[model samples]
Target: MSFSLTTDARETFIFAAKNVFRDYETTPPAPEPITGNTWDNVTGNEVKEAALALIRDGKDPAKDKSIQELLLRWQLSQSGIFPVLAAENENQTLINEFNAAVKGLEALTPAAEEDAQILANAASRLTIPNLGDSYSGSPRDAMLHAGARVADARLSKYAEAAGTLLYLRGIQVQGEHMTPNWFALAPLTFKDAHRHSLRSAGTASPWTLAHARINIEPAANIEEIQERINAYTTGKRAIERQVEAALPQWQNLPRDAYQDAITRAVNGETMRDARGGIVTWAN
Candidate 1:
């Protein structure tokens, strides 16, 4: 398979190693496959194919020509044109595959330049599964659905990893808040209500409010976030299902994307004390 590294290779590698050696002391635990789980029987090819099909049907061809072209590229992935991904090295493989997928997608659909750009843009946030430990720890991350602020930070990280452009959606104390550079990344902010959905009956339990609106961080963009939301719905759904099944105790939990994003956003920003509450950053 094509060889390359995604932006988060260094962090992923260290994380994966720790999972294998120390059983993931610092991060969320991977879900365990149930006895006779389909995931275990499924080969890497099957998983790749699943990803391809999800990408293929995820976007609307009429609205997103670039995504249409990307759909074709995903079809090609099914043929094994892509490089051999080192499955054991989730970070390396994800990085390599993401890079290769974008390059191949671009080459195949040069005519749809905008579409290609969009695909590449969204693909940037996609990340491989992290190293996880199921043996010693609880079946899930105890800190998964901790709180709103935590969820927001983790949501940002999830967006970063999944290639979804995100905004902090917080009140701007001043015209200029010290936020991440949107120029280098596609960051934005929205009204709290819009960014944070509240649960309502007869609808998704963790439904977010629509009133909150996003503020364009000077440097970040959300066009790709929209595209990502469209393109990988199935895969995302599958992940959601798997996570929910694994951690039924936390069902109806708020936006997992938010939680994951926040966790990664301030990866080393804080420490937790005995009650699992935040402590001052060691630094």
Candidate 2:
């Protein structure tokens, strides 16, 4: 076990004591654990004692990271102390192992180069993917359908107002004079109709018009939108499932290579955290 202070040792000692336990003030809450964490179980009072012990030994409590850290461990820690973390950390551990493997290949037969190359490739493959084409938020078909409904509603209202105006007064509303609205409106109407199976307006309810076409000169016939909403959603879901299904295979990748190196740098040893607990993942 190797433990070294991240910063100056005295400074580390100084900061570990400040406001670790105070009266009527909000203290930092305990942390939620994630990968590569070391845990401890000790009571709040016991933690306070650990801090006081630092002061007893002529050390500063406010600066002792371990004291505040132990406080976070907070009654759950039953582990031993002086968890000596190594001078070298886990990330460097892997790099050192990789370098050792590459070097060993040089000392071996011709086939050794190929094996080392595989190790290099595997190391590089460990990363998060951007996954561009798999964005599931587009919902193109659904959006098109929604847009159509809004457009139809607005058009219907306008037509109704025009009809009311013609009925009440002597103004003319030549919808044909509005033309096919062709340059844009007709095609938009067809898209909306195909996606949503919308009924034709102006032709009245239970619309008799077979397609989204108006009685205009040029036709507006296009295929209906696909039933499966969005291509992106399906594509993204398939990718997510594929990656999830490979979970077990992903667990030991570089670690296997790390162990296979000719020189096992950290073999038969336990890695320790700053608080003297075992670095679980490092092992």
Candidate 3:
């Protein structure tokens, strides 16, 4: 059977494309705001108050503890962690700190670097004919898949040493029980197979080609999604390697606790999903 991506799934795919071509934009940048709020103002005291409250009341260790301890249980659901915190909010300072904290955990190391290299070397020896680059359909699809596998292999190697596959350019995490997750460029509405790719693959086209350039709005969307996934994955893998290289240095940081941080940061879920142990994210 032919593989197809759903609207939700393809959203991530499109995001990856955008990241791939992030340096090349078709749109002109709007003039910078002469007077606009920053990440602090955007996030505001109100949200921080709420985030802190969750840490103090909902979490076991209150604000009196380390930032890592404070964030431990609250990382998931935003009920405590507050995913509503925007990067562009008026508080880029705090946002950057939080982002770094999350990235820091996924940046832990493991002992499988040599094994990964062996796998990558084996993959490099395998090749399939690429007749698709000359065409716009099956051949194109084949080429895309081949390129993705090569990239995935490289990422896998990084994860082998560090722990998590870096799906986003700046994001990283370990692999134990981690999902091969991807995010979309736009907020997605989950619908059934009636939506194009999920349904009639042979009869329907989610997008079209015109003037030798894909002439579908959905194409742009998919491209951006793909770009994000690739960027994040790359960064995530890099962090993973760093985690391995510096594992012994950060020994003061708890093992189970740190791993929990990785799960909360990467999957945005509970620590239970992170290697069957509970961990925390410092608020």
Each prediction's RMSD over C-alphas, in Å, is: 27.1, 34.9, 26.4
Q: Model 1, 1-283: lDDT tens per residue? A: 2334445653453343332223112322232322321111224455456556656888434455554555566576656544433344444444444444333322322222222233233223322122122223333332222222232332233223222112222211122232222211222232121124211111211102111222222122234444323333333344334434434443444676445433422232443433455544211
lDDT of 1 at 201: 14
Please, what is the TM-score per model? 0.18, 0.16, 0.18
Candidate 1 vs candidate 2: the TM-score winner is 1
Arranged by lDDT with the best first, the candidates are 3, 1, 2
Q: Mind giving the per-residue lDDT tens digits that candidate 3 earns over 1-283? A: 0232233433343343233223222222222342343222223344456567767677733444554433443344335334344433424433333333223322211112222333234334333323123334466455554553444333333222121112433232223222222222111111111111221222111111111121112112223544544554565555444434434433455787554444344443433322344433231
Off by over 4 Å in 1: 1-146, 160-283
- TM-score between model 1 and native: 0.18
Model 1 is weakest, by summed lDDT over 10 consecutive residues, at 198-207
Model 2 misplacement above 4 A: 1-138, 170-210, 215-283
186 in model 1: Cα distance from truth in Å?
7.8
| lDDT (tens digit, per residue) of candidate 2 on 57-123 | 9999878898867765663344443132222344444333333322322222222223223323322
